[model samples]
Target: MKFTKLTSSVLAGATLLSIMAPTASFAATSKAGSADAKTNDNGGTKLPQNDHTEVGISFGDNNSNGNTGYLRLQAVPHTLDFGNHKLLDDSKLDFTADGKNTSLSVNNTKGSFNGTNANQTTTLATGTDTALDTVKGTAWATVVDKQVTRIDPMNGPEDTSDPTNPKPTSGFHKGTDSVAGTWTLSVQATSPLTAVDNGDPSKEIVDENGAKEEIKDAKLTFSDTQYAQTQNVLGLTKDKNDNTYAKDLADLTKQPTVAPVKEITKNVSTPLVANGSDITVAKAAAGEGQGANVFGWLPENIKLTMPAGAAVSNAIYKANLTWTLNSTVA
Candidate 1:
């Protein structure tokens, strides 16, 4: 490939960056278990037993149910350094909330690793502190002179109106005029339900319930952040003063705020199936690890919608989510 002087310089810079790029890697692991079992009041060293016992031999079915959630999402941290070496705006961009392992286990099912997932979402309330005191935020984000760039076509006959590349779906907004505003953030979603009330079983029919009762204590918080961490892979490069910085591309790709222009939600619900066999295990003597995999590949749909708003620098708004279970234990 041929390279002009400018292209060569850019390519050389990129290659140099590739070699000296600094990477930040972190690793963490955890294990935890909790059971809502019975306990004796006396200071007695006594053991309990399960109700389900094998013929004469008394085989105790065990259950070691647990979930170990792990989240390893990378973020890009930006630092706004003041001339005195003080940081003005340090932003930590949590681009993703990666993994949340929800699980259950029974003894005989030790080899089986399966789980059911219930969503928990909170409705964004009407009144929120969306108003950022820009005057006081001079340290976080100084309002530089906003410019209106008519990103029409370059070096071509342009028209104020065109079909294919029409005005922005976000609206034909000018620079500063569209930049600042009284942005109102609202939570919007659709919840669907279906049921088989007073079902007929004689004709081989199964009963049904609409939507599961949603869980409680959902929350949404909004705030501005500064000083985000960076992720680099090769662990080589450094800034001008040889200060290394790592920026993770994978993390940046996970932010909900950055969902593409063509994405949309459709509300739908999947039916839960309850298999026949039921085991009777006493709560007092329930051994370690004894549960079957109930949750299969079932997808429930949730439709979402909201109005567009301006995103100021070093600002972030988070929505805590939750959902109700069918309570059917199916």
Candidate 2:
């Protein structure tokens, strides 16, 4: 019985050894596979759809977008006062004394005065010292003349503290989107200079033959005319030696600036007849008169020539002058 039991135990131990041998072989294979394992890495990339953006612009006082881009008449002379003239019996009513008439003065009823003599009032005849006393006669008919694309109204309280840098109560600004183009300025006499009856202000003075007393063959003349730009791009300025020169405000290396050196039309001695056609005083070609420009006329140069023997009268005579500005040059 003991021999048989020993044989069975030996067989059992052999079976257990076979099972443990297989388990050990599987563990050894797993460790070898882990030590020789390989790994992989991945990468990704992206691109932008667009790289830029755009902006828009426009001009004028029509919109509330704060864009100012339109041609405008900034200022003009409202009154060209030829002071009271004493009607002499034998003297011809001529103010054209080779542009030396001391009786002529321009009263700027419109726009700001930028003249060196702003408060100067000329007293043609002897009189009391009044505001009108400073109405001094000048050889030049100076007006606050400006032609611009845009202008700004007085924004806040004016600073009158400094005289040299007198803060302009009003100013003009160049439009960001302004288109450079041509322009024109013209003048016309709407009415004839007729004498008003002494007895009646409404009625005209008539002669013995019932003819209306009028200054016949009278001509308005302008001489030594010049135009200046606020930006100083183009204008006529005099040197210290009284020699006039065309001021070029562009770089010397670039093309010359376009401007007028003389009057557009020679309406010098020609009569500006009543109800006559429009006469061009000044003009600007394409790419010329841009930004704020001023027109200066020698006051003495602006004269009225009256022919002799135009019927005697002790009455006041009056006439009307109409100035027109057009965006497109004619």
Put down candidate 1 lDDT per residue, 148-257, tens digits, no spaces.
11122332444548677754433333321211111111122222111112232112212365333221222111222211111221221112211211122222333212
Off by over 4 Å in 2: 1-69, 88-92, 96-177, 197-212, 232-272
Lowest-scoring 10 consecutive residues by lDDT in candidate 2? 236-245
lDDT tens digits, residue span 1-330, model 2: 999999999999999988888543332234333444341111121221247777866321111222122444443444443434434333545553222233432322212111222222221221232322222232221111223322245546678899779785544343222233466777777767777765564677777999876766666666655554433211211112111112322322344344432335534334645786687776765566554445545455567666666664546665666766666632
Which run of 10 residues does model 1 get worst, by summed lDDT? Answer: 288-297
Q: What lDDT is obtained when candidate 1 is compared to the true structure? A: 0.20
List candidate 1 stretches off by more than 4 Å.
1-147, 151-207, 220-330
Q: Give me the overall lDDT of model 2.
A: 0.45
Supply every candidate's count of residue pairs whose N, Cα or C atoms clash at under 3 angstroms.
44, 10
RMSD of 1: 35.0
Candidate 1 TM-score to native: 0.16
Clashing pairs in 2: 60-69, 120-134, 121-134, 121-135, 121-136, 122-134, 122-135, 122-136, 140-299, 141-299
